[model samples]
Target: MNISWQGVFPALTTKFTAEGTLDHAAFKHNLQAQLEAGVDGIILGGSLGEASTLTVVEKEELVERAVNLLEGKVPVVLNIAEGSTREAVRIAEHAAELGASGLMLLPPMRYKADDRETAEYFKTIARSTELPIMIYNNPIDYKIEVTLDMFEELLQFENIQAVKESTRDVSNVTRLRNRFGDRIKILCGVDTLAVEELVMGADGWVAGLVCAFPRETVAIYRLVKAGRLDEARTLFRWFLPLLELDLHPKLVQYIKLAEVHTGLGTEHVRAPRLPLVGAERERVEQIITDALAVRPQLPDYLAL
Candidate 1:
């Protein structure tokens, strides 16, 4: 299929009921909210979506729910990176069958991978489905790194169309842009460093924080894309503190709390993951309020 995944596509969070059941209504509301807020596309079952904590059936329900609510308003991509090649393949196949736009292949979590091994993993996932795949390269959370050489090899696969580069070293983004150019779209994964990476040369952003304030983020993106670097940097600097929260180890709790505080979405999450409270919750609350209190002005069209 013709592939072009770019712009602000937030990895939409999957909300749950207090009783621990999938809150389909909340999920639909957030998906609709994102599209309404001006995101170019939506990603389901990602780290922000708590996919790791979901069962197979739950994941299926989650993806299908997004598709139903989105109603083809924009593209939808799903994370199929749960450390199993076969299982990920199944998820990819289902995503395609259900009309998803693409797959975000995450490296095997719990351990790091050698360059050659990681290259093979990407190739395997690329071969599994016809849908274009975006390599989810988040070394911090997954503990797996896709080397530049590995990236070179992976991009050769016709189906591996793009990437979500989350490495802290934003310079790597410059390197990839210089090397690949228009061959593969480079999406900046970390919200905190998005402006820096874009300055270095990234086509789009796959951000969690954007779900909370997409209008602001999308405006920043458009400014950069439109050659207004100074304006983008000003917005980025102002929003830097909030973006840093996405890098926190307890990122999920913080994000959900931001959702709760802003009336952006619900903070209810599943077990094995507790709702933030006490000092942690208080800190996250402070972060949310601190960011929203000074919400910057962005362009109006990104909301369309």
Candidate 2:
């Protein structure tokens, strides 16, 4: 289950019913859309998927269901966002048992463990399962920076294969590459930074906004990797407004609203997370409307 990790892999949002149950139909629809759009892989139960609130059974079922639907089309990777080292290991083990191809692991959830402790937490989980692990380095939102030094230590473990470089400082991508070279694959985790990171040599994207605009997302990645910078930037300029939604505090709601406009997703979210309203809702709708109105046509070279 070695993932090539070289293209757009949406950090998919978990769909839920109005009453907060898993919406299987919508979930499958979204998954199918990403696969059809030529995403390199699928990552489930990430922050955008509301990982903190989903129970163990729900997470397990997510992996099981995605694995079934993917049917070997692409790799199915699970995100482990637990607080306790023990819990993270348990979840990683469960993901491996459920047939996940890889794991996107965050540091101990909520608690900002020091470097040594953070390394140990990740190391413990890495040992618990045979699945390849992508260390999620999102210091901006997660408050834990998996420093180059920390990664230097963690990479000793063979399965510690990749990094989701979301420090919000694109320089870190270059830093990781300078240090690790190709020993570790670097996946750009920030939606807005996708083009810059890819241009600067990110191996792939763990895209958030891709859940809504899958074709454009994949297009940007493909264009960049194919050395078509001019074409990539053209689409990126058009994509930036929607990409900004993935950076907002309410990104999940914002992206889902974009999805609604594109007919790819719904506005429904789980409890404690409600739909947008009033001026806020109007503002988001305006952005989506303007983008869809002039959505750039894919270059003839891109058959997607």
Candidate 3:
């Protein structure tokens, strides 16, 4: 699949069975929902997809499964968050071999590399693979900001095609555009700020809450691009509470619960991340349930 990098691309959650194994059935079910909702691409094994916990073999299996399942209708992108440049390059090359359409490359994980080191890390991976790369510039969580100077240094590599703009500042979208112009596509990475960023000239969205509410997510993007702000704002206002679930520390568990309510997935997460319980679970559930109770009637957004 050729990536236009101009629409909704879900940062999909990894599904697990009760015994703590990959649940291909649940994963495929959610993938189908994303496709049916007219998403632009499918991104697997990212932060939301729990990339840290997945073994190398398991990551490869996900890439293979998504590649076969989507079958060229859309691109299948694997997220590479390795700590070593060697391993990151290895995964990039392997993902390309397994027919992944692109990669979401994070800065060296677990180490706070300086600007030069970070740029070199990304440049090395870009040189190693033919697959296009989206630099995951999420400094707030990751601690290493891919500043514009770093982007300038890394721009020589053609495969470093985009940035998942998670700086949590809407103005940064304009800054990227001013510096790089269209040389690098920008996808909004924060779910709560997706619409705001989209309106401010983001090329697309790398969405998290989209795991459960695929249609609404896609609709918001389509409406914004179509210049239907009133409708987009109305739908987004209704979606605000649910979208906030993606901002929590336990976003994986929170979103999995949303998926359960939506019948798109189960809440079985891997070890070190348990299912939500008690008042926390009840509070999140109430947010989801209240939004669903008055779920807005979407416009015929596909027509846009």
Candidate 4:
């Protein structure tokens, strides 16, 4: 499961049973869809995958299931969103033990640790595991921006090899490359800006909406990288509406709903979250329906 992290790696939504249990069957079905759509790798326990809601045991099951199911078709990278360095280290250890291919490590959860503490937390986790790490730098949603200066401090950790850049400022992509060059691989984390990020020289996409439209997601990445801008733009124009769903605050619910329409997943989410209802549900459904009504005929190159 050696991954280059140079293509679309979906930040998949976690499927749940109404009784608040992991729905392995549903998740596997979705994973199969992603694989069939030709994603570069599989990322488990990410923000879209409800990593925050999973217990250690639950997370372990997810990693194990994904690893076994993928069978090395793609790297199964686990996401670490923890509040303490100790917890991050422990999760890193667990991912390694479970044979996860890599980790998407977030800054310490809840507490916005300053530069030193944040760097230390990531360094500690990086040191704890052999798994390659992708630092999740989402200042908007996660609050802790892994500033270029912080990344400079983090450069010593050889295994911290990539960044999921979600600052929402596309300029940061250039800034990152200018600062670090090819030292760190950059993956676009925000969905709406994914194309822009790719155009800005991001190596891959850590995508959220791909949960529903896996083929289209992979198509755009391939088309853009292949310098087929006209083709990519044509597809992206149709994709833009659905892509905006990933930027919503309730992206998890919105995406799962889209997944349902696409026949890859269900709308069952764990609580403190509820299923999308009323106007919200209608709004999302309309978008999915409208998009599907005119879904692009993906080129043969995108087929698995």
**Residue pair clashes in candidate 3:** none
Which residue pairs show backbone clashes in model 2? none
TM-score of every prediction relative to native = 0.94, 0.98, 0.99, 0.98
Q: What is the lDDT of residue 26 in candidate 4?
A: 95
lDDT of 3 by residue, 1-304 (tens): 5577889999999999999899999989999999999999989999889888999999999889988998899999999998999999999999888999999999999999999899999999998988888999998999999999999988889888899999998999999999989999999999999889999899999999899999999999999999999989999999999998888889999999999999999999887999989999999999999999998888888889
- Once fitted onto the true fold, the runs of candidate 2 whose alpha carbons sit more than 4 angstroms away are 300-304
TM-score of 3: 0.99
The lDDT of each candidate is 0.80, 0.89, 0.93, 0.89
Report the number of the highest-TM-score candidate: 3
Q: lDDT winner between 1 and 2, please give it.
A: 2
Q: Quick one: how many clashes does candidate 2 have?
A: 0
Displacement of residue 70 (Cα, Å) in model 3 is 0.7
Q: Candidate 1's error at 113, in angstroms?
A: 3.2
* Candidate 3 error regions (>4 Å): none
TM-score of candidate 1 against the unseen true structure? 0.94
Q: What digit string (tens of lDDT, one per residue) describes model 4 on residues 132-242?
A: 989999888878888888899788888889999999999999999998899999999988898889999999999988999999999999999988899889999999999
